[model samples]
Every structure is written in structure tokens, then in C-alpha cells.
Target: MRLQDLFINEDLSIKDAIRKLDETAKKILLVTEDKKLKGIITDGDIRRWILKNGDLNQSVSLVMNTSPKFVYEKDVIHAKEILKDKMIEAMPVLNDKEEVMDIIFWNERFSTKFNQQTLENPVVIMAGGKGTRLEPYTKIIPKPLIPIGDTPIVERIINRFNEYGCNEYYMTVNYKKNMIRAYFDDMEKSYSVDYVEEDKPLGTAGSLYLLKDQLKETFFVSNCDILIEGNYSDMMKYHKENNNKITLISSLVHYTVPYGVIVIDEDGSVKEMKEKPEYDYLVNTGMYILEPECLKDVPEDTFFHITDLINKYIDEGEKIGVYPVSESAWLDMGQFKEMENMMEKLGVK
Candidate 1:
């Protein structure tokens, strides 16, 4: 990997810094000025910044870690020890003049990350909805079986989880359930996918009631149409450490208004005028890490959506948690345009 690819200007906007992080897919960026390492920023830094509702337009220097761990050129052999001791993915090598000479990546196999993570947690996928968004195509085939490249979107989602050693899967099935079952049954797989038959269209959380007796531990629940790229083990760690009843795996989505907007008072006077503004939100990625006990709250056999469950917890003064990922880390395929964009993003035909 090119060390230059991970370099970013210290004054770059947080919004653009996220873009650079996504472009490099390195989970980190080196903040440099005149080839001198000024600081370092990671996706974790950006997530924390967004949580505080910090302006995305703010410079990355505000969120970067100024005293980042590094190794000097003469101590190149110690780079491994520093990286290992700090548990960081990479370390910058500095010359006598404090110039960034190169970067030493802890994970030499850069094709993937967290090779040491092994998750025993089971995954539950909500795949029973009648996907009306895909239009005429859904009239014939199920959304879970809808192909992106040569593989279905659901398979891509599973493939991602599979990398972390999650082998057991439970899928809630209703519409075109047989097709979904047949496809996986006939194909070769390393993991086991069990079916949780939904007699009707059980809104997201309703079908989960069926798994109450089986899932005695913390498990993953995901919608059928989206994919997220991140460290699942780290997310699991956050979930357990926080003792959260439910953790929403949200993405920081940036929505830009196309036209100039005007803010008006009730008297019809323009209060404020601004150019096209971009809004950043922690959007629900239709995925969650849930404790099994939360399933008891789901109304039995009713069309209870996940939002209803989350709202119930909120109303009872229960604290829910959110794990935010970068905008590019989330790939959603709910609508036609989103499906096309996801395909394009994945470089799939």
C-alpha cells in the first residue's frame, strides 16, 4: 500500500476527511503539513465527532490525536512492538527531522482486517417483508434472492459476517420463502442457515418473538437489503461492554439539498437564507446487536416494527446505544436507485 494514499491535510474538513478515509479503506488517516506528521485521525475519531453533533465542515485537526504513537526511522525494528503494544493498526515512521518517512501496517494482509476476531454469536436476518421497492421484479422473485453481481445481496451480507467466524444463521421468511430456502439449501455453504417461518408479513420485530426460546445469548438482527463494512467484533465488544439492551448499528448519512432554501417565520418573513446545505444524520442501518431478553417485549404475533420496540425502551427510560460507521461503510439497496448505486459502488455489473 502507498503511504501517500493515507495522507491528508490537517486543515481538511471532517466531511472530506471521511471521504478520504473511505477512499483509502484504511480506517485511518495521517494528518500532515509539509510532510511532517501533524496528527492522526481514525474513523473512531470521526464517529465521536459526529456524536457530539460537531459541524462536519470543521477542520479534522479538531478531532485528530495530536500525540499519535509513532516510531523513528532508526527504530524501525521497534515499529512492530509499538504497534502491538498500542494495539493500533498502523504506525508512522519518522526521520531525524520528524518527517513521515513511511507507515508500517500491523496487519500485513491488507486485503482484510481483524483476522484474529472470532465471533460465536448467531445472526438473525429479517427477510420476510414483501419488498415493494424493487417493483415488477419483486413480483417474480424475493428480494433476498435478488442478485447484485453474481451473488444475492443477502449472501453478500452473510459473506461479510462469515469472515468473522459467525456460522449459525436464522432467517425469518414469508414472501417467496421457498425460493429463499431452496437457493441456500441447494448451494454450498460453510455456515448453517436455519429458517424461522413467518406465517404472515411480520414487521421487523414481530417475527423475532419466535426466536426467544432459542437465542439465549446476544445475537445480530439485520434487514435483508443493506450491507455494512466494519469490524463486527469491535461492535460486539461495544455492545457487551455497554450492557445495552439493543445497539443500533447506524451510519452517518450525508443528505444534500439541491436547491437554495429559505427559513421563514409564521409571519412569512425570511428568517434565514442559505445555499445548498448538507445534513448529517445517524441513520438506522436496519441492523442491530440485540440481547435475547428484548424479544419478550415484542407483542406476540402482531405486526410490531423494530422502531416500536426501540421506542418502548426509550419510553421506559431505558438507554439504547448506537454504533456509527462512515457514510461509505454502509451500502443500502432498498429502492431502485439505491440498488443501482450499491451495484456501482461494489463495482459489480
Candidate 2:
């Protein structure tokens, strides 16, 4: 698509800009006013805006990059040089009047596919939860079998890792182990997966105890129903670079209070009164990277959550890192409502 195709008016709503970003498959858009370039906004910019609890109804100008990197139409060669130097995906080209003339893509300069190197670590999927929030659907088919498009949710989760060349998979199952096993057994896949059975319900990270000895290297643990939008390789790299015993993927979520909030003092006097307000918070996205040593601390059997493991490690002064991703990138399909929201955002009918 041309640069013009990705243009949004300066007054365009943040919500609409997001739609345009998804529709174009381009992570960015140029905000213009009467053919004049006002600024540029990328998916990352919108995510940061949301992280700051900005209103979705706000104008695109509120989050656009006013001083975005760009070069004149006469400086195309210089733009190419910049692209090469920065290793950026694309750079906008402007005419004498500062109007977007064209966009120079990385592929145009370097004729090679931008692929991320795959890591050969095992990905442990926690799929045993009885998706109580999904209700009647969970009653018929296992939560892992819940379809996100044509494929099951678990498959989508695994396929995402597959893109990064993560092959070995260790899935913990209990509620509907047979169905999950049969589903994978019938599939034709390039990767290998091993199912760890839990005789009883093992809370979140409990079933991982079964693979205690097998996983000696650093590995990943993810809930079957949640999907992350950031690069797994980058997160893994952060984990190793920081020497973290555990790395948790956190999603920035924006929550707005509908009603006016009042603060009262200890003596019951009204100290402050504020209208509806919004807040941004980092929510655990149920995705994590863990070192093998972390698994040893998990007791066999009994029930234990992954959070418990994190707390124990933190209390012992172990390093734990949090990699934040955009809210749009973290899809939680454990609940019917959240699944619907994710589907809508994905343009999945």
C-alpha cells in the first residue's frame, strides 16, 4: 500500500486509527490535514497512549509523532542511508511542503526477508484449566479445543511460537487430557509436543512439576488461552540478558472509572472529589520465561500457582523481569467476553 493509503486526518479518533493500522497491516499511519503532514502515529504510539490511560475518543494528534523521522523527496538516497543505518522498517518521504510523497520500506533497500532467529527452547503450555468462564462451550469441548478462527486456541498459541522456530512443546493437561491429546495426534505438524498428565487438578503451574528433570535449560510457560503480541525472541533475550530467574510478560491495560469518585478523610470528611477517571496498569498476561531452577522450587502434587513461584523467587532475591506489551497484543480467550473482544480486534468473523 502507498503512503497516502495509510493517511489519517489529524482529528481522527484513536479507535479509527487503530482500525486503519490493522486494515493496512502497516504498524503506522501518517496524520495529515489538507494534504499537509501533521505527524505520524504507529501501533506502538497508540499502545503507549493507552498505557498512559489516554481516552480512545481523543484525536490522533494527541498521540502522533510530531517530529517523526523523515526525509525530503529530493533526499531519497539519504533516506535509504538512514534506513540502512537505523535498521528501521520504513521511513516516510516528504515533498518541499512537508507533505507525504512516498514511503521507503526496509525491504526496498535490503532485499531479504526480515526473519527473527528461532530459539530451540521448550514451551510449556498450561492447558488444564476448566475454562469455567467459557461455560457451555467448555462443557462440550476442552478449552484448548476452543476455536479462535479455524484453528483451536492452543494451536494458535503454539503456531505463534512456531513462527519464532520454537519446536519442542510440553503441555500440561488434566481436565480433558484425552481430547487435547487426540486433537494433536491427528494434526500434521513440523514441531513435536509431549503431554504431561495431571492425575488431579494442578493449579496453573503445578503440572509443570512433571517435567522437572527433563527441562534443564531455560524454557517458557504460557497459559493456553492467552496470546501475546510482542516478540518472544526479544522477551527471551531480555530474560537472558537480565539474568532473570523468571520473566513475566505484562500487558498495559487502561481502565476508566464510570462514576465520580470521592475520597474521604479518617474523620469522615470529604477530602477530594473527582469526576470519572481512567488508570493504566500492567496486567500479567499469563506468559513467562523461566529457568529450570525455578521449577525445582515447585512442590510435587498439591496445588501451586505460578505467582507463588514468582513471589518465592523474589523473596529469595532472585532476579525477575517484566516485559510489557500492548493491550491489543494480549488476547485472553479464557472468558467468553474477552474472546469476543479479541475476535473483533482480529477481524475474525
Candidate 3:
């Protein structure tokens, strides 16, 4: 990766920093002034800031880790050790003048393997929906079979879970399921996938009842059309550490209004007017890590959405957490535009 790509001005807005992070996909950024590191901001920092409900319009300087770990170029011998010890993604090497000389990434210096941390959790993929967004494409093949680059979207989702050592997958399929099953059966894979057929159309989380008895441990539930690119192991660790019964994954998404928005009082008095105001929201990414016991909450043979279950937990005052990922980390293939965007994000033609 280019060092220049990781450098950002400290005065940049936090929302824009998010854009930069997603743009680079390096998972880290160095806030610099004249090549001297002012501070550093990684995905973790942004996630924490977002969790605390920090202001998005504020400058990066407000959210950056002012005291970031770094090493002098002359004393680069322990850079790798420092990176490993700190559990950070990259190490910045500074010269005697205290300017950025080079950057050493964990994968470049330390890892001789990939996804060393193994997780045995089963993954439940919701592939039943007819992707009406890509109308012409879905008319022939199912959404799961829709290609993002060369690989099908569902396969890509499975491949991501595979990295976390997930071997067993339960796919809930309905529309053109035979084609999906045939595609998987034709392809050679290391993991196993059992098809969970829904005789009738079940809303998002309704078909999950089929696996109530089968999945007895903590498992991941994902939509077939999305690929979330982040550390699944870390997310799982967060789930276990927080003692969360259900953890829904989310992304920090923002939208800016093109024109000035006005808010008027009931008496027709203007109360507020802001030009091009931006709004930041923690949007659910349609991926979740839920305990098996939660499956009991799913109504039998009834149309239900995952939100219904989450609401039930909320009504019961049960602990339900939402894990946040960067805007760049989540990729969706739901729409025609997003399909092209997903391909671009994955660097496919």
C-alpha cells in the first residue's frame, strides 16, 4: 500500500475521515502535517468514537489518538514486535527529523499465515429473498447466484466466513434454490453447506426457526447479498466479552441534504434552518451474531423479521448490542449501482 494514501490532514472532518478510511481500505490512517505525524486514526478509533456518539462534523484532530505508537527509523529493529505487542495493523517509522519515513504492516513483517485464529461457529445465510433491485438479472438467476466480479455473492459471503474458520453453513433458500444448490454442488469447496428450504416465503428472520434445533451455539446470520470486510474474529470476541445475547453489526453511514432544510414551529414561526446539513446514522448491515436460545423467540410458522426479535429482547430488557464497522468495511450487492460499487471495492473488472 502507498504511504501517501494513508496520510490525512488533521483538520479534515471526521465524516470525511470515514470516507478516507473506506477509500483506502487499509483500516488505518495517519494524521500528518508536513510529513510529521500529528496523530493516528484507525478503524478501531473511529468505531470507539462512533460508539460514544461523538460529533461527526468535528475535525479528525478531535477523534484521533494523539499519542499513537511509532518508532524511529534508526531503531526499527523492534517495530514488528511493537506492532504484535500492541495488536495494531501498521507501524510508522519516523526519521531523526521526526517525519514519516516508512510504514511496516503486520502482515508484511509478521504473519506467515492467513486467518490464524480459528472459530467454529456456524454461519446462517439468508438467501431466500428475490432480489427485486436487480430486476433483469434476478429474472434468470437468484440473487445468491448474482455475480460480484466472477464469484457469486452468496459464495463470497461464505468465503468471508471461511476465513474465520467457519466450516459449517446453513443456507436458507427459496427462490431458484435448485440453481443455488447446483452451483455449490458443482464447485469444489473445503466447507459444507446444508440447504434450509422454506416451503413458503418467510420474512427475514422467520425461516431461522428451521435451525432452532440444529444450531446450538453462537452463530452468525448474514444476508446473501452483502460482504462485510472487517475482523470477524474481533467482532466475535466483542460479542463474547460483552456477554451480549445478540450482537447486530452496523456501519457508520452518512447523508448530506443538498438544499437548506427548514424546521418551523406549529405557529408557523421558523425555528431552524441549516444549509447542507449532514446526518450520521448507525445503519444495520443485515448481519448478526446471536445466541441459539434467541431462536426460541422466533414465532413458529409465522412471518417475522429479525427486528421483531430484537424488539422482543428490548421489551424484555435483554441485552442486545450493535457492533460498528467503518463505512468502507461493509459492501452490499443489493442494487445495480451497488453491484458495480462492490466490484470496484473488491478490485474486480
lDDT of each: 0.90, 0.84, 0.89
Residue-level lDDT tens digits of model 2 in 246-349: 98888766687999999999999999988998666779999999999877888999699999999988898989887767667788887888999877776685
Counting clashing residue pairs in each candidate, in order, gives 0, 0, 0
Per-candidate RMSD, Å: 2.0, 4.6, 2.0
Model 3: how far residue 129 lies from native, Å: 1.4
Give the C-alpha miss distance for residue 70 in model 1, angstroms. Answer: 2.1
Better of 1 and 2 by TM-score: 1
lDDT, candidate 2, residue 134? 94
Q: Model 3: how far is 59 from its true place, Å?
A: 3.4
TM-score (all chains, Cα) for each model: 0.93, 0.81, 0.93
TM-score of 3: 0.93
Provide the lowest-lDDT 10-residue window in model 3.
108-117
**Tens digits of per-residue lDDT for model 3, 1-349:** 6788899998998888889887877778998999998899988888888878888888988889989899998789998778767877787899988899888877867655433458999999999998999999999999999887788889889998998899999999999999999999998999999999999889989999999989999999999899998889989998999899999999888878999999999999999999998888899999999999988889898889999999999999999988999777789989988888999989997
**How accurate locally is residue 53 in candidate 1, as Cα lDDT from 0 to 100?**
80
- The collision pairs in model 2 are none
Colliding residue pairs in candidate 1 = none
